[model samples]
Target: MPLMSDGDEKVDGFFRLGTSSGRFNMFDRFASLGVKWTGAVNGRPEDEFGLAVVTASTSPDYRRSSAAQRTESVAEITYRAPLSPWLTVQPNLQYVHNPGADPTIRDAWVVGLRFAIGSRLID
Candidate 1:
């Protein structure tokens, strides 16, 4: 989805929604949004930042059978460093509220890092 951007796609965002028509799928519905902020960061014009949030609900049948089933949500934040044209490093944080949509399961906070290396395209 092309979104508002600064030349070279510096800032952009997206929205998503999903629903299942099947009776067996556990996910009855879900939605999420993701945003990216790139370039012009803290004097470093190449750094990138991202944020996302997701919410999902258990299927009607599952919720009816499980007393603890309910809607669940997760949010994440990340920062990416461009080491070169072909390499980038990203550190991300994630927080889940009511994992598994089961009230008995405590929420969790997770931290992670990701690396991206790709070949530069030559014209």
Candidate 2:
């Protein structure tokens, strides 16, 4: 996360653009943009089905007031099935990225869920 510039020492965890020694120079600036998409599908034995989709984006001017900027995006999906009248389960997944970073962040994941529980009281 070190900002780079000519004739300047690389400082750790510090970010700056178009500047030297915390001074505005208006010569070292950059911009960024991004987009994402997500989708999912599900079905059941009794003719039940489901679908979903999501999209997100970030602009370079979201935070930085100087000439430098960064952007990111993420997407997700989910599916479900019916095992019985009172019981059901679903799974979820996601993806993320940041195209303006050194590592170009990327990731994926999966999750599970359940529903319908019976409780008994004993005296």
Candidate 3:
């Protein structure tokens, strides 16, 4: 996926004008595009399971802020496998990036896992 934006403007004192006729106004615009692929293998060397991959990107532009432009990207991977006849486990990992900011909450890597148990209750 791909995205693009282009515009021309002129500002005189407090008034602004666009290239055509409309007045230039301060606004924030954002655009995002992504792609994903998923498939399952009946029998393979790695594992007889499913696999998926997703990638996304975002671009944000602000005309009236100290931070004018910003970009971010993220990727996630998940794997599921049968532990036993009545148990299953899934693990996930993610990568993220944020440009222009302190290392507080936006720039980091995350990992997680999930487990499921299936059984019939006996009375």
Each model's total of backbone clashes: 0, 1, 0
Give a tens-digit lDDT track for model 2, residues 1-123.
Answer: 433322322222322223222233322233222221112122222322222333222223433443322433334444445555555565656554443322334444435454543232222
lDDT by residue for model 1 (1-123), tens: 545666544777899999995278767899999988877466667887899999998888887777746688999999999887888899999999989898888999999989998687342
The alpha-carbon root-mean-square deviation between model 3 and the true structure, to one decimal in Å, is 16.1
- Per-residue error for 11 in candidate 2, Å, reads 54
Ten contiguous residues with the weakest lDDT in model 2: 33-42
Better of 2 and 3 by TM-score: 3
Candidate 2 regions with alpha-carbon error over 4 angstroms: 1-53, 59-61, 65-72, 99-106, 114-123
lDDT of 3 by residue, 92-115 (tens): 776766533223446668787888
- Best first by lDDT, ranked: 1, 3, 2
- Output the TM-score of candidate 1: 0.83
Return whichever of 1 and 3 wins on TM-score. 1
Show model 3 residue runs off by greater than 4 Å.
Answer: 1-69, 99-106, 118-123
Which residue window of length 10 is worst by lDDT in model 1? Answer: 1-10
- Displacement of residue 32 (Cα, Å) in model 3 is 9.1
